[model samples]
Every structure is written in C-alpha cells, then in structure tokens.
Target: MPPPNERDPLLEISGLRTHFSTREGTVKAVDGASLTVPRATTVCVVGESGCGKSVTARSVLGLIDHPGKIVAGEIRWHRTDREPLDLAALSPTGPELRSIRGREIAMVFQEPMASLSPMYTVGDQLMEAIRLHKEVTKDEARSMALDLLRRVGIPRPEQRFGAYSFQLSGGMCQRIMIAIALACDPALLIADEPTTALDVTTQARIIDLLRDIQAETGMSMLFITHDLGVVAEIADEVVVMYLGTVVERGGVDEIFHDAKHPYTKALLGSIPRMGAGTRQRLTTIRGNVPHPSDRPSGCPFHPRCGDAVPGLCDVEEPPEVVFGPARSARCVLHAMERSVR
Candidate 1:
C-alpha cells in the first residue's frame, strides 16, 4: 500500500467504454470501467477469461485496432512536469500518443512470441526502441540495450543481445520483453498476463523480477491477469472484474480477507489451498461468463452468483457501496447491508 498523502494520480480512468463491432453484433468489451493508479503503486486487475481486463489496458494505451473503438471515456495521464492530458481523445496514430506509448507508458503483453519479431535480432529491436524514443546514437543505444537486458536479470546479456527471439526460452523472451518495455524508463507499466505461458517456476521468477523493478524505479504498474495467485503475489490493490465491469476493488488484504461481493467470494473459494485435506473435486464457479452480446439484464454476474438476492440482483444494478477508506464494491448485498446499517 502507498502512503495516504500521495499527491497526484499517474493515470485516472473514468467511464471507459470500448466496443468491438462484429458481423454478429457489437461486443461491449469494456463498459463504464474506471480506476486510478497512484504513483509508485501496483494495481492488479483479476478476472476470468473474456472479462475485459486486457481490453481496459489496451484502451488506456489507445492500442485497439480496426474493429474496436473507444465509445466514451476519459484517460488522464499526469507526467512528472507537464499538465495532465486526456489520452482517450488523442488520435490513435498521432505523433504525441506514439511518443508517450513506449516512453511514458509501456506494455508487456501475454505472448512474447507474438510481441517479439522473429526476424529481428534482440539487439536490433531493443536498440531501435531506444533510438526511436531518445536521441541516442547507435553505440549509446546498444550499450543501453545490454544494460537493460542485464537489469532484467538476463544471464550473459551481451551474448543474448545478438540472438534471435526464437533462440531464447519462453522465460528469457519474456524477460527481454520486460527489458524493452522498461528501456525508456516509462512512468506507468501495463503488464497483460505476462507470465501466462511460462511454467510455475518461471512465473515466480517473472513476478519477482517485476517486484524488484517496481521497488527500484518507484513506477506505477497495472498488472492484468486471470490468476488469483499472481494477484496475491504482486498487487497492492485488487480490482475484480466481470463482464466488463469492476464488481469489487480494495486493498489486497481487504479484498482477500473480507471480500464483499458474492462473485469475489466465489472466486476466492475456487482457489485450491494446501493442507485442506483431500477432496474428490475442487470448488468451481457455476456457469460460464456470458458472451458480451448476450449479457444478462441487470447484474452481469447474477446468473453465476450464488448469493445474489432475488429482486435486487436481477432487477436493478447495484450502486457502488463504500465500506472503508479505500474499499468499495458493486454488489446488491453490500448495498443493502450499508442501507440497513
């Protein structure tokens, strides 16, 4: 957790809506989402697959291509010296946004193979990224590239720099991606399921590397993943999303120890814990998340939520219920409890 006296937020998102137009129908990938990333804080967004975690991050970076568009939103970015700028309004391919994309705010995607170019040498790519953002000579960029590789804990970075992406293992490729993303010293880093394809041991190493880098740089990060274990490992705050909406958000301890939303409770209950005695099967949340085009009428989660009250959860959307100084949830149970209190 960060200190209460933190002055300004690095990124502020409000009423964000991102929709994708398909032949079938428009998919509301991100609907009215909002959150804040305080400077030097890590906010982990956890949800099931297709819950809009990645879409929200892409929307912030203006990375949505052809079929997708930002219907409405305000993404305000506050740099160290300059005034805050609304990123949502900027042109997708404009020079200003491009300048900020990798330099001010960078993203490390889920699949390293997809992100890294197979044809380009790692050194060429990293050096090009450095030279693109900063007015550094080729020699200076090369030095910086090797330095970043080493900083990300890549063994024998100098030797690895000249290697192709395919030559490195999954873990090494991911570390290279992280190194490239951090090459410009970005103020905000968005990691979208960075360790999804790696083994358990490799995943732990990546998580540790991120924590170490965050501590060293004091940069804000938005870690997006579906894994609860990853959230528990790296998040200062947790945002639980369902069908493009944030059902609950709070400090890590608060969300884990005293989750208010029924969906959140179900999610926590689903995680397998050690020493719980052998059981025939692990607990599972019933029903799949509805498709974006076929979302339920009222609460998006009502169909799968076991504790959803009859009338309130099915007929009307619940208001955000503020529980403590830094915790809130969008759940009818929480709303009714607060009203009764």
Candidate 2:
C-alpha cells in the first residue's frame, strides 16, 4: 500500500454540478459535489434516494444524457503511467472517453436486467468487451470470457455463456454483469448499488466477490449506495451526501461513531440495531428528500435537520469545516463550534 502523503488519488472530483433542463424547470441534481477515491481504497458515497449519488457516478463516467448536463467542476483522473485527464472536459461520445470508459474505468450498474441486453448472448457481450480493449484473437477472447465467468462464481460457465441475459436468474445476471465489468481489468470500478435488487444472501456473496477481486487486483473503487450497513462493511472512507451535496466525509469509524453533522447523525441512527429489543422501533428521518427543482435555500437539509439553528442554517450556506485530519462537515453548528475552539 502507498503511504498517505505520497499516494496520488486515482480520481478527484471537485465542485461537480450536474443539472437537468426539464420542461418544468431546471433540476439541480448534483450541485457542487466533491470527493476523492484514493488508490486501492474504497470510498462509499451514501445518501437517501434522489440525493444525486448515481448522478455523481454517471458524471464521473461522462454518462449523463440529454437534458442532464455536467455544468461545472473538475473530475481529474490520474491513471498509472499516464497524464492526468479531466473527465469533465471530455466529450461524452468521443473516442477518447469511449476508450477510457470500459478499458480504464468500469461501472457495475444497479440492475443487471436493465443494463444487460437481451438481444445478445452473454458470451458475445463478454467477449466483445474483452476484445474491444485488448489485442486478442476471437478464440482467446472466448477463453478469457469463460475464465471471468468462473471467477465470478457462475455455475456451468460453458452453458451459461450461450444463454441470453433474460434466461438467467437475477443473481446470475448480476454475476455476468460483474464479469463483464472486470473483463478489462480497469484501474477504477464504479459500483452504483450493485446489490440493490438481490436477496440478502446473494448480496453478501456479491460484496465478498468484489472485495476478493479488489484485494487481488489492487484497483480503487467508488461505491455508491443508500445502505449504511454496506458502507460499514466495505468502506475505508465515507462521503455523506444530501440534496446533491456532500454534508460529511471521513473514515467509516468517524462517520458512524462521531458524526458531527445532523444529517449524517440521523442517517446513522436510522439503521436498525441488532441486539435491541423487538419492541424498539427503527428511527427514521422526518421528511422525504426535497425535489431537486424545489430545493430549499441555504443548507438543503435544514428543514429536515433536527438540530438546525433558526437564523443561520436557513439563511446561509455553511462552509465546510475541518473537524480532524481528513474529516469534515458542512453544517453551521460544526462551523461555529470549530470557530469558538
């Protein structure tokens, strides 16, 4: 592992804003979001639905579509043995971005059923992915695809390779998706809720598979999810996002035990405790996440934050205050407390 001070981040996102130009109004999906994924480490982006977690990932991969555009900020990616490339400045459809997408950076989407094409057989899709980025013959590509299927723990690798995505079970399809994503051995993997629709047992297996692969390959991962349990299990560092902005960021232990922001605290509190009595109800946040077009002013979470101050939190956006080394929060209370000390 690289030393903290000397380690160059594999990906650094700064002040990223992705908005959609809708017929009703412009939706500010991701407003000034920033975070970093250090080399060979897992950085999990956690938030409730509609908090722009997926948008942030899509923006990083230049996958935002029509009506939605990444209007500002820098996504600087540093690949090994190459110059730093600003992903935000690259064309979404150009050859440069296409080459980088699957070859250098890969994404495992939320639903394999939706992401996989029923028109093509699994072998065709996997072999195409391998051949696109690698200089290999057709026979070699097929061999690599089968090897990947086996690596991801798919049963009957040869039989499954001939089947289309629709013919496979959800867990099987998800495994194939993982196999395809890992086919090229990319430096960075963006897993956007990869375990969302799977059963608990399958989810555990998939998470374990990813961990084993990361350990063996030494690739960095940017994991985006709403599950705190998943964050606790897999994350080296955590970024807490709300309303398209990061509210708190720190080590997993700090975010879970010493959360300084009300939003982060509430989120952690909402997780169900294991040994608590059956009579105890699980905690929940007060209200639903605000719509992007109808977002409140100042701190986007003030209306929902339990400890929000009257004058300050609703009127002014709080500057990010450093609480410790590599730990920070965007909240008026923390900022004021830090100033007094």
For model 1, residues 149-196, the per-residue Cα lDDT tens digits are: 999999998899999999999999999999999999998999999999
- What TM-score would each prediction reach against the true structure? 0.96, 0.97
Which model scores highest in lDDT? 2
Each candidate: what lDDT? 0.90, 0.92
Residue 271 C-alpha lDDT in model 2: 72
Displacement of the residue 23 alpha carbon in candidate 2, Å: 2.0
Q: After superposition, how far is residue 82 of candidate 2 from its true place, in Å?
A: 2.2
lDDT of 2 by residue, 31-96 (tens): 999998988899999999999999999998899989899999999998666678999999999899
